[model samples]
Target: MPFPLYLLAMAVFAMGTSEFMLAGLLPDIASGLDITVGTAGMLTPAFAIGMIVGAPLVAALARNWPSRSSLLGFILVFSAAHAVGAMTTSFPVLFATRVVAALANAGFLAVALTTAATLVSPDKKGRALAVLLSGTTVATIAGVPGGSVLGTLLGWRATFWAVAALCLPAALGILKGIPAGRVKEEATGGPALRTELAQLTRPRLLLVMLLGALVNAATFGSFTFLAPVVTDTAGLGELWISVALVLFGAGSFVGVTVAGRLSDQRPALVLAVGGPLLLIGWPALAILADKPVALLCLVFVQGALSFALGSTLITRVLYEAAEAPTMAGSYATAALNVGAAVGPLIAATTLSTTVGDLGPLWASGLLVAVALLIALPLRAVIAAGRSTEVLP
Candidate 1:
């Protein structure tokens, strides 16, 4: 764990905060821009679209550049975008800024993950990714809620200014901490774009991407509707929403910590533990929605299980496609966002068409079950391969 890793974590925290803070400030933004909340809510997915589009594009463009320089440039652009966003009043300008910020975020994360991975040994990649993703869970815990309060007290624009301020220290640290010429110029062009794309089509890489997506779909699908389920179904009222969310965040933090420690030696085993937790947690969540305490407890467990997949997914992809590390990581990021997109759509559709308030829970549980079915066989293969080597 070099100091640069922690600095990268700080950089990730700043970007992660901007990514999620919009969710909490959508109401204020809607009123300020004179748009409906639903229209304002579209900013979240717009950002995701930018992320999906940006990662590979940035990797191609910056293929020759050093990771430290690329990281600094992206965060600088990200900070400036937020600064302009703080001054903008029109909805279109704000939305454009969101997309711009998201593009910067995507590029930064793709580089950061690969850079962090390369800095450590093969076995330590799990911990490296966990260090980086911990920032995201921390944002869920602190940044989103804090930004919401800031927007309520000051204005939505104030939150943007605050986010801009957060980026400054990270940019400075990247400049000072990450040594120049640290990352090797990537293996001097062995493959063309067509070949690289063809390589990425391998079944193992695809499975890893699908695993990333499914795990996230399960986590976020159910979470998107948690407020309604807690308040309406459990009769817990609005205040409990905040408490439940905090508990969820706390559980997420714990999960990442524990998973980081174990995933290096037992990556597949971590997934084995995590997948079943969702299987048990979700049905319990649906059944116990009538009991506030039980619902809250299950939410915590589900949150932990959901996020515990983060390191395992990334580590698995890294090993599966070691030859194309940057693209592999970018693909994983895109895949996880794909799941993020899918989860919400499934939950929203289930609520509108079929299931009622409990729809998301049931839908998410089924998704986790499918992901587990995928994981079980994959885990068996991984274990078999390892056993063959060990016995030989």
Candidate 2:
């Protein structure tokens, strides 16, 4: 990969860390602000909601700005938000900081991926996207663990401070490493926006967005409550739960890498495989939760299969929506955040009155099965579209 790709990846790593670290730090943050852990948990959902709102808003506003400038500005905003969040004594203030930080994060990711795709040839788009997105997977493997450890030892605020420190170096790296002309310029003004919005109205693109949302809902619904389920139903110790999360992170690392490679070869097949795997894994996870050894294995498998869909789906959407790639990419990010927001809500509601923790898993499984059925007809639409040829 190019040096600019590495710089983009670094920014993504910090953003990923910032987004997920809240979960690990919730207890410390709650105690510090004299709020309930449930209230602290609201931070995660708040961030996702902000991302859903920010992706399109930022994309539309920054459409004419230089990509390099836009990226640097968003990083500055993100860094400042984290710094403020770390210093704040009030829960509400901290929550607002998180929301602002999430806005920056969502905009950065959408811009970064769109920028990455433009930097490479069409055939190599998947690889470029993979290189950029690997930072998020790496964050799962390294950033979350390190942040959690830091939070445990030095308090959650310290973790945010450390994360804030990273932003400066990441910004500097981007400034120095990425060339001015790295991002391709689109035709600007009213015509560009109109063209992009029209592409979004296409049935094929809309279906892909819906499929992306459904797939995410399926995976995240169960994943959002994984720790509690492990403790309550699996009868595992907290330490074991942490170990399982690490295992899941390991699987994500491998999965993202494999997905990157396979997407370049067969994007559609990757999606086809992912939907069924999600459907199977959820129910299987419910069954295996009682067996500690089996549960660990399932965690790895579930992580791998669940995340494997990402790169493939992204590349396919970009390909199919070539007329307005940036807008499509932004919409895709919005869809992802929408799923993130909805998934946990569904899981929490189902688990509220259930007999066991398995309720979430079963609910997630059924949701994925429905998504899979919906995707079948859409897959045919994509195939049929590809089969047609236009006359010169």
Candidate 3:
């Protein structure tokens, strides 16, 4: 609805591209850097670790800065870190660069969420947040595939270079579009932070965070090792694996778009429906892996249903902690990153010690079940919130 929101979306697109392109380019990066694929995979975790640590820390540090300036500075830092990553030949140096880049990227997202909330009226907050977050889905559909194709045609380093270049324009867009002032009129008094922290003490809000973590664990735990499972375990060709990824990305785009629209109407219903579908899709996917067509269909369904829950879940967190919207949003993002970091490591261990690729599916199913159980208790809370006179 706002021009500044569009600029923020572009920033999100660039960040998502940089973050997710690694999965497709992992092999290329490993070969280029004379490292194993296993080692290359660590970069994903590194980025998540950065996000987990950076979101709250940076949000706190930038609490007093003008939102526009903070966002622009973070983008510059993001661009610079990627530039350094593209140029580095040493493994340690590249790792450090990734950490810095991811930290900036996480900080950028936290600021962007806060900025988006400020850009819209209270009643339209859900839709506004959904529109801003939809950029991540768009990146999955367009940016990641485009960057992966470029990496295949050119080099992995070239992909990072492109991401770095995109960030420059994003930074400039934010500078020109967003007003240069503190986004929130409410002062970030010490008591405000304390109140925000206290919001987490509520069972409803805490349940939302735990559900967020479980949902992420269910999807990402299996997704992190998708390529290996497809190629090595399922006997699919490399090209097929790429096609599956693209299919998954397509599903993600559709899911998020639909979820965004539905969130404006009935967020709780979307989550109640979508969460179980995600759990169901995983086992179905594992069962159909040997059949190319079936597996592809399952991949699409899995991707769609898995990500479809995002907006609803995040909205749930915000609703539960309405008194501290920005801090709640930041913590929500932090919880997601923490899950992202933990999921893959747990999956990796399961795969190594277990009999089949089914390990991830089973584990994911269990995680999803736990998340669903958590959501059940919150039904009354959400229903009560909806019945209230609150507009947003």
lDDT of 3 by residue, 146-236 (tens): 8988999999999999999999888899999999755643464433666666887887677767777777777788777777767876788
* Rank by lDDT (best first): 1, 2, 3
| Candidate rank order under TM-score | 1, 2, 3
Q: How well is each residue in 190-234 modelled by candidate 2, as lDDT tens digits? A: 347778778877777776677667667766777767887778788
Each candidate's TM vs. the true structure? 0.93, 0.93, 0.92
lDDT tens readout by residue for model 1, 1-392: 77888898888888877887776688888998899999999898888889888877876676557888999999999999999999988889989998999888888887887788888877787787788888888877777778877888999899999989999999999999988887524546545545555657787778777887887887778877788987899998777876777777777877887887777777667777777877888888998999988998888888888888755776666666566755656776777778877888888888875558898998888988888788776675432222112111
Query: Considering summed lDDT, which 10 consecutive residues are worst modelled in model 1?
Result: 383-392
Root-mean-square deviation (CA) per prediction: 2.5, 2.5, 2.6
What is the C-alpha local distance difference test score of each model?
Answer: 0.79, 0.77, 0.77
Worst 10 residues of 2 by lDDT: 383-392
After superposition, candidate 3 runs with Cα above 4 Å error: 185-191, 232-234, 353-355, 382-392
| Best prediction by lDDT | 1
User: Which regions in candidate 1 have their CA more than 4 angstroms from the true location?
Assistant: 187-195, 382-392
lDDT score, candidate 3, position 288 = 74
Task: Supply the global lDDT for candidate 1.
Answer: 0.79
